[model samples]
Target: MSAPRFALGATVRIAERTPPVHHRVPSYAKGQVGRIVRVCHEHGLPEAYIRGDGRPFQRLYRVRLDQKALWRDYAGAAGDTLDIEIFEPWLEPAE
Candidate 1:
């Protein structure tokens, strides 16, 4: 096992690239900024899984994003949030 690329409470940005095939990152999360709320267990990358690579494992994180930030016309309360589980490779340190 290797050290996790991201620490708890760290802010990160979801990569916006569109894959040619199956992917786990949702369309709403692309390019969105969020904070790491929890560090879940490591798992294989879905990208690799779709490609039949069974040995690749990456850290999974539960990120919390404000609902208002994801939707321009969101009518929910200011405190509403969305939690998403994302793989390490799909995330980068928020600038």
Candidate 2:
């Protein structure tokens, strides 16, 4: 199989399914639009989820989105943005 295609500055949609209970992924960000920034090397969830290390740093794609896309009509700077670490499974080709 070919390496999954993804690109920097590419638009992706976060799926609607809720994350595992107690996961670090935030609830508000579900089903949001974000631009893929980086495709980090992959690692197993079990190894990445080792306890006692504070936040679990799961292998994920770094995404950057405009604050307005995440929150409409908010009183934040127009240039404000949000950077979120989202697993590959959580994202799909937007539209």
- Highest TM-score model number: 1
Over the stretch 7-94, how does candidate 1's per-residue lDDT look in tens digits?
9999999999999988899899999999999998888888788767745788899999999999999999999999999998999999
| Reference-based TM-score, model 2 | 0.72
lDDT of 2 by residue, 16-62 (tens): 87544455567778888888888776543432454545333344678
* Alpha-carbon local distance difference test for all models: 0.91, 0.71
Model 1, runs deviating above 4 Å: none
Question: For every candidate structure, what is the RMSD over all alpha carbons to the true structure, in angstroms?
Answer: 1.1, 4.6
Top candidate on lDDT is 1
- Deviation (Å) of 12 in candidate 1: 0.3
- TM-scores for all candidates: the values are 0.94, 0.72
